[model samples]
Every structure is written in structure tokens, then in C-alpha cells.
Target: MQKVTDYFNKPLNLLPNYFKKIGLGFILASVVFVVSVKISGIHPTAEKKEMMKIISKDVVLLGMMFIAFSKEKDEDELTMLIRMKALASAFVYIVIFKIVSDVFGIIDQELIENKNGYFFQMMIWYFFVYYSAKLLR
Candidate 1:
């Protein structure tokens, strides 16, 4: 037990698990969003804008829970700045990717059928940024 714990507590191992927590968070929130849609018997895509408004809050709560824990160890100011830059880039990329996919008509229902679309993309982006940060460091 001690050996296992010691191995993971290494800075390297801790990083992946931290990002994995982010993935789990997106999955949990997505499940709630999908289940809510099914149980409510409201599949109104026309009302989708309103639906997003309702569930948008869940993203915040999930972020607070998952991302808050990812910062378990104190980082140096330089490292923190690098992370902030990475986050900004991640945000821009998500926005641009979503827009381009929508505008170019490249995506279809399969990718987003159950709000899983958002969650799926989020997982991919988190890992991209997470690993990129690791490599940059």
C-alpha cells in the first residue's frame, strides 16, 4: 500500500490523475444532462437554447469540483502563468472548433445527440492541454 501510494504521489503520476478527474467530471455532468432530457420528455431542439441555459450552471459546479482539486500542489508563479496561457488557448480552440464545425456543416447529430458532443470534445481538449503543459514544462 505504501509503495503504491508513494509511486502515484510523484509529481508525474499525480498529473495524469488530476486530468482524469476532469474527464470524470465531464462524464458525470453529461450523464445528468442527458438523463434530464429523457426524463422530462422534452426533446425540443428548438427549445435547446433554453435547455443550455439551465444546464450551463452544472458546468460551473463541475469545474469547481474537478478543476479545484487539480491544483492540489502549489505551483511557482511562472508555472501558473504558463497554465493560464494554456487555458486561454484551450478556450479559444474550443470556441473556434465549435464555430467552424457548425459553420462548415462538418458535424452531424451523432457527435452531439445527447449533449455527449460537448463532453466528448471537452475530454479531448483537456487532455491536449494537459499533456501539452506537461511537455512544455
Candidate 2:
């Protein structure tokens, strides 16, 4: 049990800090592409639109993963502790969101149908918690 706890508590091998900038670039590019397409008024066929959406979402997810895995400028014990706490909080938030949405039917069925959206929401929640905790501390 102690070993298991230690393993779980171990800090992850994060990517280089520079990856955060690359991730931001990816996210910005995706947003720009989408906005450009929309503003250009080039109405693609339904299939094309769906493909674009999937691609854009994938790019955004990739960017987010990069950002999440990249190390902070000063990676230390406190930051690791805060990261873990933020992750746990985000997980709890997702569970609560799922339960409440299911019980109240507040969320759109379409959004729930897409796992990418669900995972994206989790990432968003994690960032929110992580940044807030860092700032507050």
C-alpha cells in the first residue's frame, strides 16, 4: 500500500517548458483557421464541416495535452503537490458535472455524445483549478 501510494504520488516526467509555447501556437492556429473559415463565408458541405470540426477539435486537444504535460518554469515539490490537487479537483468536478447533467438533463445530448467534448471540458476544468490555485497560493 505504501509503495502504491508512493507510485501514485510520484511526479510525472513532464515535457520541456518550451512545449507550452508550441501548444499555445497550435491552439491559436486552430482558432484562427476556424474563424477564417467562418468569416470567409465558404459554406462547406456537411461532411466537410464535420471533418473540419473533428480536425479542429483534435488539434485543440493535442495543444491542451502539450500544455498540460509541459513543465512549469520552476518545477518543484509544491508545484507537483498543487498539480495533483488540481487534477483530483478537476476529476471530482467532472464526476459532479456528469451526475448533475444526467440527473437534470441540463446538458445537450449532442455534447454528451462526443467524448472529445467531455475530455476537453475536463482539461478546461483542470486548467481553471490549477491556475486559480497557483494564483491564490
Candidate 3:
């Protein structure tokens, strides 16, 4: 038990700065790809739609991977604590949003038919909120 507690209490390991930069690049690439796809107005054949969905998900996942692994500024105990808090807050916010949306019928049913879409969106918002909270401190 002592060993386990000591191991878990060790300092955070932050990724190199380049990871964040690369993540931002991948995010930008995804946005551009999506915009181009929308602008092209190609008819959505089954395979094409599937391809697009996969590509979109892949890019976003790649970006998320990089970002999640990247270092925060002054990556220390305090930052880690803040990150944990931010995640908790983001989760609560999303839960409330979900409840309100469901109660008020504010969201489209088809859009949330698959919970993955909502989860992905919540993750994106989670990072945004975390960064915002970090900046405010």
C-alpha cells in the first residue's frame, strides 16, 4: 500500500512543447478537410460517407492524442490539480447541459442518436474549459 501510494504521488510527466504544436496543426488540418468536403458538395455515396466519417474521427483523435499528451505551462503539482478540477467541472457542466437539452428538447434527436458524438463534443469542450480556467487563475 505504501509503495502504491508513493508511486501514484510522484510528479506529473509532461510531454514536449512540440506535441502541442503538432496537435494544433492536426486540428487545423481536420478543419480544413471538413470545410473542403462541405464546399465540394459531393453526393454522399455510402462508401464516401463512411470514408469521410472515418477521416474526420481519425484527425480529431490524432489531435486529441497529441494535446492530451502535451505539457501544460509550468507542469507541476498545482497544474495537475487544476487540470483534475477542470475535468470535474467540465463533466458536471456537460451533465447539466445534457439534462437541460433533454428536458427542453433543445438538441436534435438524430444528432445524439449515437452517444459517441456527444462524448467527443464534450471532450473538446472540456479542453477548452480547462484552458480557460487555467488562464483565469
Q: Candidate 3, residues 1-137: lDDT per residue as tens digits?
A: 99899888876566786898898898898889888878998678889889888888788878876786677657876667777776787688779867766765645665445555665666777788778777887
lDDT by residue (69-122, candidate 1, tens digit) is 355354555555555666666677778777766655544645434443554465
Ranking by TM-score: 2, 3, 1
The segments of candidate 2 whose C-alpha lies over 4 angstroms from its true place after superposition are: 1-10, 106-116
Q: Per-residue lDDT for 1-137 in model 2, tens only? A: 99999998877889999999999999999999999999999999999999999999899999998998889999888888889898898899888888876765654665455545678989999999888888988
Lowest summed lDDT over 10 consecutive residues: which window, candidate 1?
A: 11-20
TM-score of each: 0.43, 0.84, 0.72
Q: Model 1 lDDT vs. the true structure?
A: 0.59
lDDT of 2 at 38: 99
Cα RMSD to native, each candidate? 11.4, 3.4, 3.3
Model 3 stretches with alpha carbons more than 4 Å out:
12-14, 39-44, 105-115
- Quality of model 3 by C-alpha lDDT: 0.75
Q: How many residue pairs clash in each candidate at the backbone level?
A: 0, 0, 0
lDDT of 2: 0.88
